[model samples]
Target chain A: MSGNSNATASGAIERLWKPLVARSRSKRALLLMAPLVIFELLIFVAPFLILLRISVSEAGERGTAYAEGTWSADAYANVLTSEVPREVIVHSFTIGLIATAIAVAVGLLYAYAIWRADGFTKSLLLFSVVLPLLTTLVVKTYAFRPLLSPTGTLNSLLESVGLLSTPLEIVPGLAGAIVGQVYIVLPYAVLAIYSVLATMDWQLVEAARDLGASRPRSVLEVVVPQAMPGIIVATVISFAWSVGSYAAPFLLGDDVTFAMRVEGQILRDFQWPTATALSVVMIAAMLVVISALVAVLSRFGGEVEYA
Target chain B: MRRESLETALFRAGYLVVFAFMLLPLAVVVVTSFGASGQIAFPPAEFSLTWYESFFDQTDWLRAFDNSLLVGLGTAVVATILGVTAAFGQEIDDGLVGRLLAPLVLLPMLIPPVIFGVTLLVYFTEFDLQGSYVSLILAHTLWATPLVYFVMRSVFRRFDWQQLDAAHDLGAGPVRSFVHVVLPNVKHGIFVGALLAFIVSLQEFVMALFLSNHTTETIPVVAWNQLRNSLSPMVSVVSTFLILISLGAILLAAAATNLNWLSKQLS
Candidate 1:
C-alpha cells in the first residue's frame, strides 16, 4: 500500500511539474486564469483574512468598528458565555434541522413525482421547480409574510373552512421561519435528487416490486439506495443554507438566528469584534457539523459515486 | 391492477399538495400585488394597478431599481468574462493547478453570504470603497462568478476543443481564435451564464444590505428596509417587477438553451 501511494504521489508530482516545463499550452492557460485568480484572492480571500483579524481584535469604542492591531480573545469568550448568542445558536440549529428534514423529505417526493411524470406533466413539474429557483430569494421568501400572516390568505382559508375561529399567528414565528426556509431550499433539493433519479433505471424498482416486495419496500430498497447521493447533497445544501439563512427568518419570522445576531452586532450595535467573532464561531461550528453530516450520510448511503 | 390505480391516485394527490406548498407564496405575492387597498389584504377588495403606479411614482423606489439594474448588469459582464476565461483555463490545464483552480472558483458558492457580507463590509470600509458602485459590483461578482463558472464548465465539457487547435494552426491568435472560433459555438452558454449571474446579483440581499448606503441600496435592500417598517403594497409591486424580470431572463436562457440543458446545469 505504501508503494502504491508512493507511485500515486510521484505520478501526481510528475503531472504537476511536467505541465510547467514541457508545454507553452499551460502558459496560455495561466494567462487565461490570472484575472479570476487575482479577483478571487483580492475580493474573496483577502476579506476573509480581514474578518479573521477583526474577530481577534479588541472591541472598538462607540462609532468605531473595532480596535485594530490589538489582539484579544475577549470577544470569543463573551460569545461563548453569553445567553443571547447561545439562544441564537440553538435557534439557528433548530431551524436548520427542521428545514433540512422537511425540505429533503418533500424534495424526495417531489423528485419522484417529476421522474414518474410524462411529456407535458414532466416539463411542467420541472419548470415549477426551476421557476422558484430563478425567482429572487428575498422576493419568494418575502411572499410568505403575506401568505402566512395573522390576516394572510392561509388564515383566511383556514377560517372559511371552519378549521379555526380566528387566525393562529404563524408569521413572525418559528413555523413561518421553517416553512419559508424550506421553500427557499426546496428547489435545489428537488433538482439535486431529481438529477440522480434522472440517471436511475426504473426497471430495478419495477423488478423488485414484481418479485413480491411491496411498493414502499421496493422503493426503499432500490430507489433510496440509488438516490442516496442526491439526498446527501440535498441535506447538506439545505442544512448549510438554513443555518446561515438571513432572509427567511428575517422576513417571515422574528427569531434571532446566528445570521441575524451577527447583522445586529455589526450594523446596529457597531460591535465589529463581537460580530466577526460570532461569525467565526458560527462558521467553525457549521464546518464541523456539515463535515460530520456528510460523513454520516455517506455511510448511510453505503457508497457515494461522486460525479 | 386496482392497487396500482389507487397508488397512482395517491401519488398524484401527494404531488399536488407538495406543488401547492412550493408555489403558494409566489402565487400569493402575485395576487397581492394587484390589491388596491391601502393595507395589505388577501383576496383583494378590488383589483387595480395603484400599487404598481405607486412603485413607479416613488423616486426612492425608482433609484433603488436603477441601482439594482446597474449592479446586476455590471456583475453579469465582469463575472461572465472571468468565468468563461477560467473555464477555458481549467479545460486547457488539466493538471494539479487546474484541480486547485476549479475548487477555488467554486468556494464562494459554499461560504455563507453573511460572512461574505460582513467581511467585505469591513474590508471595503478600510479601503474607503464602502457605498461605492465599484464595491457593490465587485461584492456581487464574487458570488456570481462561481455560478457562471459552474455553468460554463459544463458548457465547455460539451464543446469541441479541436476547433481552437485548428484556429491556432491557421495562425489565428488566441484572442482571435477565441473570438471567432470558440465564442460563436458557446454563445448560448455565455448568454445563459450572464443571465444567471444577473439574476443572482439582482436578487441578492444580505451582501447588499451590509455593503450599500441609502444612495447605493438595491431593490432588495430597499425592500428589506421597507419590510422592517411596514407591509406596503408597493413592496409587492416591486417584487412583482423583479419576478417578471427574472422570469423573462429565465425564458431567454431557456430559449438560448433547451430546458433539459438548463435542468442539467442546475445540478
Candidate 2:
C-alpha cells in the first residue's frame, strides 16, 4: 500500500509539473470553459481567499482591514476565549441537531409516502413539500407569528375553545428558531431521502412480512436499512443547512445563533477580528460537514457500481 | 373493488395532515393580505384589496420591486450564459474540465450566505464595488449559476449528442450547430434554468442586504427591513404578490415551453 501511494504521489507531482499535457488541452474546450472559470475565479475563489485572509487578519477599523499588518491568529484566540462565541456555537449545534432530527422524522415518512403513492397523488405530495420553498422564507417564518405568538390568533382560538388558559411564548425563542429551520430544511431532507427510497425494492419488505415479520418490524428491519444511505445524506444535509441558518433566527430572535453573531460583529460592532474568527470557526464546521458529505457520497457511489 | 388496508389509509391521511401543516401558513398569509380590518389578523372580520392598493401606492416598495426585477433580469441573463457555457463545457473532453472546476464553481452553494455576504461586502468595499448593481448581480450570479448547472447537467445527461454531430458534419460551424440543433433540444433546460435563476435572485436577500444600496434595494431586503421593524399587513401584500407572480412565472414557462421541465428538473 505504501509503495502504491508513493507511486501515485510522484505521478501527481509529474502531472502537476507537466506543461506538455496542459498544451494538449483542446482549444475549443478551453474557450468554452473560459467564461465560467474566469467568473468563478473572480467572484467565488477570490472572495473566499479574501475571506480566509480576513479571518487571519488583525482586527482593523470598520472600513479598512488588513491594510498594513501581517497575518495573525489573535482572532482565532479571541473566538476560542469568548463566552458569546462558545455559547453560541454550542447553541447552534443543539438547535441544528434537534431540528435535523425532527426534519428527518417527518421527511422520512413523507418520502416513504411519496414512494408508495402512484400518479397525481405522488405529484401533489411532492408539490406540497416543494411549495413551502416556493414562497419567501420570511413569509413562511413570519406566518408562524399568528400561530405561536402570545395573544396571537392561535392563543385566542385556544382560549375560546377552553384548551388553554394563557398564551405561549413559542415564536420568539429557541422553539421558534427550530420550527423555522425545520420548515426550511424539511423539503430538502424529503427529496434527499426520496431519491434513495424511490429506487428501493419493496418486494423485500413484502417478503419479510410474508416470512412473519410485523409491519413495523418489516419497515424497521428492511426499509430503514435500504434507505439508510439516503437517511444519512438527508440528516447531513439538514444538519449543515440548519447550522448555516441565519435568516430564520434573524426573524425569530436576535443574537440567537452563531450566524447571527457573525452578522452582528460585522455590521453592528465592526469587530473584524471576532467576526472573522467566528466565520473561520463556522467555515471549519462547514468543511467538516462537506467532507463528511463527500465521503459518504463516494462510498454510496461505490456501492452502486459494485451492485 | 379492492380497498386499502387500515395502514395504507392511515398513511394517506397522515400525508394530508402533513400537507396541511406545510401549506397552512401560506394559506394564512394569502388570506391575511386582503384583511379589511387594517390590522394583521387571521380570519379577519372582513376582506379588502386595500393593502394591495397600498403596496402599489408606495414608491419605496415599487422601487424595490423594480430593482428586484431589473437585477433578476440581469442575473438571469449573466447566469444563463455562464451556466450553459459551463454545463456544455463539461461535456467536452469527456469531463476533464468539469472535474477540475467543480469544487471552485460549486463552493458558493456550500458557503453560508451570511459568510459569503460578509466576504463580498469586505472585498467589494476594498475594490470600490460596494452597493453597485454590478456587485449585486455578480453575487447573485455566483449563487444562481449552480442551480442552472444542476438543471442543465441533468438535461445534457438525457440528451443525445449525435444530432449535434450530424449538424457538424453538414458543414455547420460549432456555434451554428449549437444554435440550430443543440439549442432547440436544450431550450427547455435553458428556459427552466433561467426562470429558476431569476426566482432565486429575486428571493435571495442575505447578499442583497450586504451588497445593495438604497437605490438598488431588492424586494426581499425591503421586506426583511419591514418585517424587522414590525409585522405589518403590507408585508403580506408584497408576499402574496410575490407568490402569485412566481406561480405565474412557473406556469407561463411551463406552458410556453410545452414541457413540464421545471417540475421534472425539481423532482
Candidate 3:
C-alpha cells in the first residue's frame, strides 16, 4: 500500500525507462500485430492486387487468358465505356444514394421517436430497430422474396382489403431491392443516430424551452445540429454498405445495379477482369465518400475518436 | 402544445409503421415455417410443425448447421485471442505505431464484404487453399477481428493500470499481474467480443458464398442455396432457428456486458 513503491514501480517502469525499453516494447507490439497484419495482407490486400493485375491482362480464346505483353488499361476502358457496365455503375450509385437517403430519414425519425418516448415504449421501439441486424442476410432476402412475390401476402393483403384490383409485381425489380436494402441498413442509421442522441446534452433543449423556443424549434435547432455527426456517419456508412451490397440487389433486383452486373461477370460469365475492375471502381468511390465524410465531420467538431 | 402533441402522434404512428415493416418479412418467415402446407406461404391456412420436422429430417441442414457452429466458434476463438493481444499491445505503448495500425485493423470491417470475399477468393485460389476450413476461418477472422479489437480496445483504454502496478510492486510477474488484475477487469469485454464474433461468423454469407464448398458449406450458404433451388418452408424453419440462436446470443452478450450500453459504443 506504499505510494512511493507503486509510483516508482509503475511510473518509472513505463516512463523513465522508456528509452531503454522502447525498442523492445515496440518490437513486441509489432510481433503481437504480426498475425493480424499478415492475415489481412494475405486475404484482403493480396486479392485486390491480384484482381488489379488480372484486370489489365487480356482474355484468351477459350480458357483463362493472360497477356504475354505488358500490362494495359484495356479492362478499365471496357468497364468505363461499355454500355452495360456504365449503366450498372450509374444505377448502382443511384440506388445506393436513394436507399441511403430514405434510410437516414426513416432512421432519424425512428430514433427521434424512441428518444422522446418514455419507459416501455422507448425500449420496444429500440428493440424493433435492432431486430433486423440479428437475422441472416440470405434468410431475410428469402423472406422478402415470398412476401413480395406476385401472389404473395402483400398482394393478397392488398386484394383482400380492396386496396388493389390486381396483384402487384413487387419482386425481381429495383423497388424490391431498395426495400430490402433500406430494411437492412436502417438499423445502422438508427444505432448511429441514437448513440449521438444518447450522449447529447439535454440541458440545451431545456435552455431553449426556457428561452421561449417551441418543442419543434428546439429540436430542429439544437437536437438536429448536435446529431449532425452521427447523421453524416450513418449516411456515409449506409451508402457504402448499400453500394457494395451483392445479396439484396442480386436476389431482389431483376439485374439492375452495378453490383448485380459485377456479380454476373464473376459468377455467370467468369469475366474476372471486368468484375475486378468494377470492384475497384466501387471501392474507390467508397473511399472518396468516406474521406469526404471524415473531412466534413472533422470540420463540425464531431471527430470519431474511438477509445 | 397542440402542435407538439400532433407532431408526437404522427411520429409515433410512423415509428409503428416502420417497425412493422422491418418485422413483417421476418415474422412471415417464422410463421410460414409452421405452415401445414408444404409450400412457403404467409398467413398459412393452418399452423403445424411439419416444416420444422422436415427441417430436422434433412441431414444437409444439420451438417450445414454443424459446419456453421464449428466455423463460428473457431473464428470467435482465434479472433478474440488475436484481438485481445493486439489491443493489449496497443495499450502498453500508446504510441505512433499503434495509432498507425489501428485503422488498418479496421480495414476488414470498413471494406465491402464483396471486396473482402473476392480478395480472399483470389488469394485462396492462388495458394491452392480454396475449400479448406482454414481458409474460410481465416476469411471470417478478418471480419471478426475488428469487432473484437474495438471492444477490447475500449475495455483496455478504461482499464485501471494501478492494480497491475500494485501487483508488480508486490513482486508479481507480468504474467501473474495480467492474469490476476487485467483479465478480471476485461473479462466482460472479451465475452462480449466473442459473442459478437460468433454471431457475425454464424450469419455471414457473401465471403462464405465465395469460399465455402461441399465439405465446408455453412448454414447461411446452405440456406441460400436451398432457398434459391427449391420452394419450401423448410428453409423458413431453419431460418427461424438461426434467428432465435442469434437473438439468444445477442441477449446473452447484452446481459453479460450491459449490451444496451455496448451497442452505443459499437456504433
Task: Enumerate the chain B TM-scores of all models.
Answer: 0.96, 0.92, 0.95
Give the alpha-carbon lDDT of every model.
0.86, 0.79, 0.79
Q: Write the per-residue lDDT of candidate 3 for residues A9-89, one digit (tens) a residue.
A: 898757844653465556666666667666666666777778788778775445554443447777788888889877877
Per-residue lDDT over B1-267 for candidate 2, one digit per residue giving the tens place of the 0 to 100 score: 123377777777877888888888888889989898756788777988888887778999999998999999999999999988887877764445567666667667767788888989988987999999989999999978987877888888878988888888889998898888888888978988898889888888888988999999999899889888888789888988888877776666656553223443443
Q: Give the Cα RMSD of candidate 3.
A: 7.5
Off by over 4 Å in 3: A1-27, A65-70, A117-119, A292-307
**Interface RMSD, prediction 3:** 2.6
Per-candidate TM-scores read 0.93, 0.89, 0.91
User: Which regions of candidate 1 deviate over 4 angstroms?
Assistant: A1-25, A302-307
CA shift of B216, model 3, Å: 1.0
Residues A206-228 of candidate 2: C-alpha lDDT, one tens digit per residue = 88878877776777667776777
lDDT of 1: 0.86
For candidate 2, give the docking quality class from DockQ. Answer: medium
Model 3, B1-267: lDDT tens digits are 788799778877888898898788779878888889877777888999777767777888899988999999999999998888889888877665577567787766766777677667767887898888888888889878888888888899899878878999999997888999899999999999998888889989988988888989999898888766776888888888888997787678767876456666556
> Which candidate leads in DockQ?
1
Residue A117 CA displacement from its true place in model 1, Å: 2.0
What TM-score does chain A of each model score against the native chain A?
0.88, 0.82, 0.81
Arranged by TM-score with the best first, the candidates are 1, 3, 2
Candidate 1 residue pairs in clash (backbone atoms < 3 Å): none
